[model samples]
Target: MRRLSTIIALFISLSAFADEGMWMLGNLNKQSRQTMKELGLKFPADKIYNPKKTSLTDAVVSFGGFCSGVVVSNDGLVFTNHHCGFSAIQQHSTLQNDYLQDGFVARTHEEELPNPELFVRFLLRTENVTPRVLKAITPGMTEQDRQAITDSIMYAIQDEIYAKDTTLVAVVDPYYGGNEFWLSVYRDYTDVRLVFAPPSSIGKFGWDTDNWVWPRHTGDFSVFRIYAGKDNKPADYSPENVPYHPPYVVPISLAGYKEGTFSMTLGYPGTTERYLSSFGIEEMMNGMNQSMIDVRGVKQAIWKREMERSDAIRIKYASKYDESSNYWKNSTGTNKVIRQQKILERRREMEATLFRWIQDTPAERENLLHLFSSLELNYKARREAGRAMAYFGESFMNGPELVQLALEILNFDYEAEEKMVMSRMKKLLDKYANLDLALDKEVFTAMIKEYRSQVDSLYYPDFYATITDEYNGSDHAFIDSLYAQTKITTPLGLKLFFEQDSTYNIFEDPAISLSIDLLVKMFDIHQVIQEPSTNIERDERLFNAAIRRMYANRNFYPDANSTMRLSFGTVRGYTPFDGAEYDYYTTTRGIIEKAKAHAGDRDFTLEPEVLDFLSSRDYGKYANTDGDMSVCFISNNDITGGNSGSAMFNANGELLGLAFDGNWEAMGSDFIYEPDLQRCIGVDVRYMLFVMEKLGKADHLIKELNLR
Candidate 1:
């Protein structure tokens, strides 16, 4: 039954709802004519502005990968994903000051601690590169040729600009296969600092278990400031540098919109998989979700155990634990929904209808479907074997060591990349090797024994080879001699060797290097080895067929990823799966209620003096009684991860709220936008003001806001 269930899940893996398409933006077609007309969302091409609509480009910045943010201040004061800001917060954390667990706010400019690795991107310009780009390439071009042409054109464009603006970078992005192109110029700043954040209790109120599940009480938002040169240009860390002062910052309106008001979320959205094949959905539903669930479940257990016994581990893995727990819940929830199958069936029907309508020949359709199918099959073939890469997957954890090794290699004139690879091997060897020969042999033998006992033989071939070779080799005396010469014995001895030896090379020794080489070879083999070409061909045919069909309908576009897209919707409310309806409201009262619940909980423990203000409902000091909106509310705006810190604006261009999260119902927006299910949650400007005035007791900060 367990095996059967696992097989069933593999077929359901592609159930991404919110992942691939234009979020919930496709509902523009299905929107009631009355609602659409009321929203006045039919902004024509002339009025619509790209990032550089005017002197002030909507600061398009990526806060690593989990989320995105926008610059609300001209002088580089940016807003972005709360989750995105997590790493920065974590980086700044120390034993004495747990910034991740406790929120941080730097009241003064000098008070703000510079986050060395944090970066913000300014979208300088974007242009259609299709004509110039495609001129050098053609339809029958191979992927290699297409990439070469694309890279050449991109380099040419960027090189020209790089000469003018050394701070800026030009990236060429592809759209509609190889037919269309967008060349974008970005000004990047590395010196960023934390501005203000609610405690984890408030910022991530519901924590990971609540992520991607709507009716969410989690306040998933954060703010950051980008510092630049005194002349308003991007700059590195400098005490002399100042906050960027832009010509325009969004003006916050006290008069919040009611239901049916026109609203839009404008910011970078990371990725979408709306164009994925049904088989792809099955993979996500079964494979990705299940894998994530299993991993996160283990992580959560570790976190739970550590949270109770080890403060150090809790501190170290605060963000990781939160993420794992959240993903576990989210994946499980998503898996559950996919298993329901109604949504998948609906999506399949839509795909079928699209296929029937597209003017593609049977051959073309077959080719597309084959493409998608091949991808799925390949993924499955590599699925379990890919676990070898997991231990070294995170760029954040691995990047610094690689960077140091690259610098060392640079000293010897070796390529930085090659040095980094050597550094990786060095680390791996250190992990498995020992310092004292007898103990080393014992440790290595025991470790290999564990590997043999635990890890699947199919995955850990190199480790398996160690145990097998010890027994099978005729040179038992040679093995004893080698073991005696070996330095490593106990785990601590091996660790000490790595710590003390600065000039060890895993690649220099034949036995060690060969073993290391085998690991790498197997890792690669696991990553790429797949079913025979016949299955691959069939999958591609399936994908091409699906795309042709989807294109035929033209009812929905493939989901946009990290691509600029405009989503239109209205301020509204939604009913949750549990039959509870959320009104377009959240108030200061809710904040106080949450605060009182955690009288001393890190998220809510207000200073004793502040409690008096809440009791008095001294809202007059902070609350915009005019609209009386709770600090947070809902709007029917289609958005995703990239839309963090997006300014939610009214028709007259007044900022109403900061776009944060989509209601739980809209989690499916990742794959397919269901208008009825999609609603954007935001922190109203009024609530922001109230928090600043009443709770924060920093009414002085209000002056910086462009309040009308």
Candidate 2:
């Protein structure tokens, strides 16, 4: 293993270049500033991030920590992706009032609907405190000891910051794999409301078929308003709360941009493993990604049937389906791009160069050799465990709603669990109408079959033996029996079970028993895999430190960890194939063409009113010079999952579009950035405005943006 590691590391070469980094907002050094200037940035670096003054960073916010949004008006009107607000929209939709089917536009502030548990956070400032953190570590400290000390120091910093201002949330984030750390402060606003959202036909145009594909026409934009107390501080949802007055609001630009234009994006990008080793990449491609794709494909197949059959089911399952399908398609695309781009092979070559560099430098060689060897050995050792975890996660955790409900019942106190279960049951039945027992049973059976086939029997739950012996190795029989025997499958049965004061043995329930067994097996496997890796974290920190030193001359940005970041690039197009070239911008023509192609399909069908606007070509002021309404545009900006609702600004720092998706060819960007091929897909601000004004007749929203 050591010999193989050394050989592979000896051939590694660094390939960081172009607009390929999610740069820290507080650490825009001289080199990064120069790069941004060269890319056509007109504003000074201080204008982008100023603690004492309102800057561009103040306008960008973390939308519920999972996506990004921008403050577009002084009254805190937030702009984000429709999919980011999907769950809230679904919550408000029903057969009589289906906002997901027919678009919704809040004509007045009073008309807007409040979303429960929704929040947006504005970044106050970011400060580097690596020195203070590392001061707590001693030379002879073990990895666990170092972690404990680090956590203590981090808590101390957070406490100190919080003591100064209780409203501000202070978080110390580790970067460069724990070699560095930054302290970020944010003010969270919880009283967010839905202002506007186009129907699924426009917001989710092409649906699963066109999710990650380029030349997209999906509007993908939603508007929400953040409300605060009379004092203008963060507050819970109340009628007394007023619209928040933001420090900065992005100025909308009606002048549409073209190819080669300078573009910048700011958002909280979720995660990226750009420095992952070849072995890790191999495992992701062959194990994790493939498992996700296969399992989600089976689950979605079951859901689609139920959703298509009933409008109520469609609303209940819409958000769930979208969440599952998004990553499923992403996994499929990542696998394809990884293979097409030879990403694993390239990583191996890069590792070889790093090993050669380390050997040449004796200081680094002695320090990092063991780290490299450990990485290789650890990955090999944990492959089976990782695969097992993936199977377990997909099967039990993400498979059916029933499994999760069962797990909840098993884990919580009886009285508290009863109340929670009763509340959930009432909500599911009242809001979603009914939980489809047949569909869930089918899903459970399918998932179990896949889990049994993919994961080793050694890691399998004991319930599998019951299924095999008692049910004659039949997943169908096992699932049918479980559902038939469990009262939790029915609303009345759950209510009656909760109402009864008699002590109930949750372990006797088939579903709860199965879930508990699965949980135990998963935890046991995880422990077995992690028990041997006592020094892995320390070794990784050292390894990352060495890499940073080796590439000291080049600019290094930490991997995305749901922190605010800025990425800059040019509006560019690519020839994904030998003879086919993709244009940088897509127009209304593509939407019409898609609608015509799939006339009766709900995913592709457009509302008659929207189609009429497209046919008339009366774009008003939203049309580009060619007299065509631009829908979506592509750029080479580096982004990932959490950047879904990020604002795309032009050279002058004016809002041009909302970054929503990454092209399918760029799906592997989380691992390796292909500057020429990777593209960020954004819905044009003009299209959003057009949808608001012409289709939804949201004049109030248009005025709120204060368009220039």
Per-prediction TM-score: 0.74, 0.94
- Least accurate 10 contiguous residues by lDDT in model 2: 7-16
For model 2, residues 454-543, the per-residue Cα lDDT tens digits are 888888889789988999988888888888898667666566556653555556777777788778888898897774455556665676
Cα lDDT computed for each candidate against the true fold: 0.56, 0.85
lDDT by residue for model 1 (451-497), tens = 33333555454424653576563234434544444333235434444
RMSD of each predicted structure: 8.2, 3.4
What lDDT score is found at residue 326 in candidate 1?
56
Q: By TM-score, who's the top model here?
A: 2
RMSD from true fold, candidate 2:
3.4
Error of 1 at 271 (Å): 1.0
Predicted structure 2, TM vs. truth: 0.94
State the local distance difference test value for candidate 1: 0.56
